[model samples]
Target: MRCLYCHAVIHEEMSWSDLLFKRIEDPFCGICKSGLLEIKKENSCSVCSGKMEGSGTCGDCLIWNEHQMYHDVLHSNRSLYEYNQLLKEMIKRFKYNGDYAVAGCFRKKIIEEVKKLPRQTLLVPVPVSEERLQTRGFNQTEALLVMAGLKFECLLTRKNEEVSQAKKLKHDRHSGENPFKAIQQLNGENILLMDDLYTTGTTIRRAAHILKEAGAGEVRSLTIGR
Candidate 1:
């Protein structure tokens, strides 16, 4: 097989285990794989999986929990990698440059995490505004889930067109009106929001807020980057 990111051939020797049972090879080459900075769970905050000094929630999560509008809106969030330079460039290419095949590099990890969630939990891809979707040619979050071969409910819609999150300042990220609105009413079903990145987490919290208002229970999130 070829590396998903760099398109190099992957050469592997057959082992006894490989002959005895079916084994799925990694879709990335060593060089590309090594560049991925995975966030170890042990050193991360309980709420957002962000790096922290101790075994507790991070300052950002605490502030969100304390805020009246976002209090307890999101139960937790987990991310696969750090927003390092390599990842930033990859995201820029995949998201802005319309390199849809880049989504394949993350398919295995995203599928694995989704499988670990409860069977009853609903997978929800955070929505993009119509204008943004048209400009980008696709919703990056939805593309990630689709490339992973996962089923997700399009339960939310964007209420307004807004500036890109990457260009938004921290205060601007948090201060804007919530742009998400639920497209369907949930019957207290548990939801797991899927997104490509989590910065200050204003986007996830805003989406979670709308999910709660639409009768969802125990909203959590899984992101490709933190």
Candidate 2:
């Protein structure tokens, strides 16, 4: 195969990261990783851009008192992709197939999205329950963060294993009160919360509220897919 940036011939034997990292480490490869790839962004509503802003919930959110529910919250969030078939399959393979090797494929994209934020932003991966952690052996979100060269800390804990958020309706998922609890103080810091998928934004919002109450100066969210 050819290097995506340089068009130089690349060996198939080496994994994606090995090939990309080699090019990144090679000074002569002018078309190094930086310019070879970039994350894609789109213009849409800051909160849930599923439809036109004037159409429905967008306008309601503007005047809603829900904003007060989260302290130290700078802005609501956005996501990269709609939770369609392609994304669903990819996430399934990543989560259940033990395909950690493919994580680097997302590195460039994740870094691109993250670069739009402040450099001092600290990444916080949504925590999984102890039972889930023991079964999966690793949190895919954390792995993605490491692959993206971002610093992350597991600060929140899931109180219970509720129904899979993916299987529930958005309203049903967010209908329940926050289910996460912060065990540590964030202490007036900037944070970029991450998760594998954004089904209802319930988990992320709950985690964000916890951090804000702990004195986070600003809180934003990013997910692999929405």
lDDT for every model?
0.90, 0.65
Best by lDDT: 1
Clashes of each: 0, 1
Relative to the true structure, candidate 2 reaches a TM of 0.73
Writing each residue's lDDT as its tens digit, candidate 1 over 45-127 gives 99999998768888888889899989999999999999998899889999999999898789888877878887789999999
lDDT of 1 at 224: 92
Candidate 2 per-residue C-alpha lDDT over 115-178 given as tens digits, one digit per residue, 9 for 90 to 100: 7888788888888777677777787878888876777877778865757666788678667767
> TM-score per candidate, in order?
0.95, 0.73
- List the lowest-lDDT window of 10 residues for candidate 1: 159-168
Task: Report the C-alpha displacement of residue 129, candidate 1, in angstroms.
Answer: 0.6
RMSD to true structure for each model, in Å: 1.4, 6.8
